[model samples]
Target: MREFPQISYAFAYGSGVFPQTDGSASRPAMSPHPNPPEAILKWQKGGGKMIDFIFATKFTQHFHSLNLNRHRDHYSFLGSFGSSIISHVQDDWGAGAYFNPYITVNGTLIKYGVVNFKTLLRDLSDWDTLYLAGRLHKPVKILTEDPNIRVANQRNLLAAVRCSLLLLPPTFTERQLYTTIASLSYQGDPRMSLGSENPNKVTNIITHQIRNFRMLYHDLIMSLPNVDYGEARALQQGWMEDLKLDRPMAQDMDPAFRGNMVRRLPKSFRQKLYFLYQRKFGISGREFEGMLEASADEDAKGGLKKPVGGPFDRRVAAETDLREMVLKCVNQTVKWPSATQSLKSALTAGPSRTLRYLKEKREKGRENALCDGTIVALLGDEGNESMDSSENTTEDG
Candidate 1:
C-alpha cells in the first residue's frame, strides 16, 4: 500500500477507482470470458487511468506545508508562493479544493485534490459549493474515513433522492430514477455544454455502476414510506426492481409532503429555491422561511410530533411552477461553482498539464457522443411512449 501523511478523510474516484462502461446490465457472466475484468486488471497493474484522490485535512496550510516538503514536484510554480498562500487559495477559491494533477507516485500516474475538512463537511451538508458534494454523489473507494463526513454524506444522499423525486414524473423505472439522481450535479455544468465532458456521462455512470448505486440507495429507498416496488422481494434481495408509485408520484400530493421535501434540501440549495419561489410566484420569503423554521424546530424535538401544514405548505402544493423553480434553482446553484472550479484548475494543474487534461477529456467526449447518440436513437420513440404511458397511468392511479 502507498503511504501518505495522516488526513481526516481520503477517497479515490473517477475512471481509475471505478471504471466507466456501458451495457453492464447485459454483460455476460465471467465464466464465458474466464478472465479478470480488463478495467480491474489494468487498475491493479497500475496502468489504466490515473487514480484520482481527494484528501480532506483538518488544517489546510499545515497539510499542504507537509505535502510540499515531502513532494515538492507535485505542485506547479505555486509552491514558490509558500504553503500559506497555497492554503489561502484553496480555501477561498473555487469549491474549496486545490488539485495537483499529472503527478507520478510509485511509478503510477495519479491526480489528487486537497480540501479542508470543515469545507468538505459544510458543502456535504449545505451545498455551499456542490464541488465535493457532487463527487460524493457517485461511488468512490474510501482510503480513510471520518464519522462526521459519513453522516453528512447520508444527508446529502437523502437530499439527492428528494430532489430527483421532485423533478421526476409520477412513475419512473429504477434505471430512470438512478439516472436522474446521478445527473443532479451535472445539471448546469459548463463542461457538459462545452463538450469537455461526455454527453452520456450520466448514462455511463448509471450503466457502469448500477450495482454500486443500488448498494448506496437501497436502505434509504426501503425506508421511504412513499416509494414502493413492483417486486418488493426482489428489491429487498438487491436486484433491479420496478418502482410503483404509492400515490401520484411516490408520495402524497399534499403540499405538506412537497414542502417537507424542500425543507430537507441542502441549506444553500434550499435558500436558492426560496429565492426562485419568491421571484416566480411572488410569495413572501419571510412566511416561507418561518414555516421552514417551525418545521425544523418540530423535527429537532426528536420524538413523534405531528407536523401541521401552514400557508407555505399549501402554496408549495398549489404552485404549478414548483418543478420549474426547482430546476432553475439547481442550475443556478451548480453553474457558478463549476465554472469557477474549471478556471481554478488551470492554475493548480499548470497550463501544460491542464491542456493535456482537456485534450484527453475532449477526445473522450467525442467517443462517448458517437456511442450515446446511437444508443438513444435505437431506443427511439418507444422509450418516450413508455415514459408517457407510465406518467398517464400514474396520474390516474
Candidate 2:
C-alpha cells in the first residue's frame, strides 16, 4: 500500500451536524451552521472521518422526475465559511500551517488522492475563460473584508465543500474542485444584492461546476471495481424498466387495442414495422399508432382511397380504421354470386389492407344507417335473406 498522508483536512458546514440524541449530547449535535474548519482539521489529525458539511434532507420517499433511486439520499449544498475552510481550503487561511491536501470523497470516491488545489485552480481559470466567457460568478470579496461575513461565508463554503468532497476525486486539481463547488453553490438572489443579478455569470459558474463534476465522477466510476460497475448497471437497468412501465405510452388508445394490433405479431413483421416506422416517421410505438390513426381519419374525410400507396400503405390501412372499409367490400362481394373468387382477389391484394378497408366501411355504414333508416332496413333484409336460405336448405335436407 502507498504511504498515505497523515494530516488531511475535510470540510463540513451548513446543517452539518447530526440531530442531538440523549445518548450523543456531547458527541456533537446538529447545528444550523456549516461544519467548522477547526472541527474538520481535528478530524483530519485524528483519522478517517465521515462528516456532513452541507445541509441535506430526505424530502420524499421516492424520486419524482428522473429515474433516480428513491432509497438513495438527495443533498443540497450551502456555501458557508467555517464549513468552506474545512471542506474547500482544508484549513483556515489565517492558520499558520501549510495544509497540503491530497484527496476528496463524496458519494462515489471513498478514498482518493490528487495534486494540490492551487494548481488545479490555475488550470480551471483558463478553462473558465474559454468556455464560461466571464459569465461565471466570482467569489464575493465582501465576505473576506468583514470578520462576521468571513465566518458566515466560510460556513456556506464548507457546505459546498462537503458536497464536493463526497462527490469528487482526490486527484482533482484545485481549479477542477473550485469550478465544481462554485457551480454547486447557490448564487444569491439578484434583488437581494446588485452582484447577484448577473444571470449569465451565475449560469457560467453553475455550468463550470457541472462540467467539473462530470469529469471527476466519470473518473471515480472508472476507478471502481468491476463488481461495482455490474451492480450499478443492474440498478440502472431496473430503474429504467420501472420507468418504462410507470410512464404511460404516448398514444391515447386502450392497452387492449394495442395488444390486439401487435402483441401476437410475428417477429419478422414486428421488426419490419419497427424499422419502417423508424425510417419514415422516426417515431416509436404510441406515436406510430397516433400517426396511423390520424392518417386514416384524414384519408376517410378527404375521400383519398389510396393516400399512401405501396405494400406498407396497405399494411398501415389494415392496422387502422381503414380495416372497416376493406371488410365492407368483402361483405359486398360475399353478397354477389361470384363471392368466393372476389374474396380470393381481395385477400390476394393484401389481407392487412383488406382488413383496414373493411373496418372503415363498417364505420361509414353505421353513420349512413343513422342518417337513413332505409340503409338499415336494407341491411336487415340482407340478413333475413341469408337466414331464410339457410332455413330452406335445412328443411329440404
Candidate 3:
C-alpha cells in the first residue's frame, strides 16, 4: 500500500502505529493505560522510536533481494552475503519471522519481520509458534489480505474465542477474557521466564488497547452458542455475559470441542497430541477428526450444527492434554532456535551494540520480571477508562 514490495499481509503495531492523542477526527485517542508513565504519554504524542511490522510476503527470498538492492545500507556487513542464509534460518531454525532490526527506511527507524504467506496462515490457524499468533491476538492494523486468505483466517479468530472460553472461569469480565487470551501463547514462553517484558504485559495490552480487543473479539463472543450480552453494545463499559455451564451437558459436548481444537493444530503437533490422547484416554485420531468435520458441517445450519451448546463446552481432560502438548511443542521448537537467530543477529550489531542488546534484555528482564505490584492489582478493581477509536472494522481490518 505504501509502495512496499509484494505483500500478501502486513500490519503496523505498538506505539508507533497509534494515532496522536489529540482526540480529533484525524487523530484518535490513546489506548487506555490508566496510569501510564510520563514518557509513555509523551510517546503517544508521536514518538521517534522504531516502528514495528509483521510482513507476510509473496516470496521471502525475492523480497529480501529486492530490499537488499534498494536499501543495501540498511543491513549489516553480513546481510550483503545473500538472502538464502536468512531465509533458511527463518524457516528452519527460528520461528517463521526473519526480522531486520533498526533499519532506517526513508529516515524513519523501522523494524520488520518477514515470513511466507503460507507460514503466517498456518501459525494463525494452528498456533505454530504463537509468536505471530500471540501478537495477532492483540490489536494490530491489517494492511492487506488475499480474499481466500481472509476467509481462512476466520477460523483463527474462532479458535482464539474457543480457546479463551475454555480456559476462562464461569464468571469473568471482558478484560479478564482478553487477558486470558493474551496469556495463551505466553504459557511456556521462555521470554516470560527471563522477564523480557512485564508479567503484566498481556493485561496491560488488554486494558490499554481495550477498544481494539473488543472490536476484534466482539463478533466471536456473540457468535458463541451459550452467551448473551443482554443490553450492552459491542464496545462499552460495564459489559458482561451470562454463561450456563451445566456439567452433564458440558461433558457430552467436550469431544466436539476437543476435536475442533486438536484438529486445527499443525500436523506434527496434532499427531503428537493425538498419540498422547490415545495413550491417556484411548481416543483415536480418526474419532477426533470425525467430530471436527461433523461440527464444521453445522456452521451452515445456523452455525456448528451439534449442540450441548454452551458458549463452548466445559474443559475436558483431552483439552487439557492438548493444551499442554501445544505449549511444549511451540516452546521447544522456537526457544533455542530464537537464541540461534540472536547469535546471527550480532552480524548486524557490532561488538559493543550486540553486548548492549543482550545485556538490555537480561537486565531489563531481571528488573521487571518479578515486580509484585502489578500482580495484585490485576484482579482488584477496574482502572479508569482511556480513549479508543470507535470505527467499525471489516475483514480487511
How many collisions between residues are there in candidate 3?
4
How much lDDT does candidate 1 score? 0.69
Candidates' C-alpha lDDT: 0.69, 0.27, 0.54
lDDT of 3: 0.54
Task: Supply the TM-score for candidate 2.
Answer: 0.15
Provide the TM-score for each candidate, comma-separated.
0.80, 0.15, 0.68
Q: Candidate 3 on 1-397: residue-level lDDT in tens?
A: 3435677776656545543122222233443345655434543334343457778986888887887777666556657678886666566755667766766543445567788888887776555666676667666655554665555556566666666554544455566677777776666666677666556666556544566566677676666564444333433444423122111111113556544544444443444444554456666777766644543434655664433422222233235454565555545545654556566566545465567656755753443222111101111122111012212133234
lDDT of 2 by residue, 268-355 (tens): 2223343444454456777666654543413555673432233344344234433233223222322331223224323222455445
- Scored by lDDT, the top model is 1
> Candidate 3, TM-score vs. the true structure?
0.68
Candidate 3: regions farther than 4 A off = 1-4, 18-47, 230-273, 282-356, 359-397
Better of 1 and 3 by lDDT: 1
Residue 287 Cα positional deviation in candidate 2, in Å, after optimal superposition? 50
Worst 10 residues of 3 by lDDT: 371-380
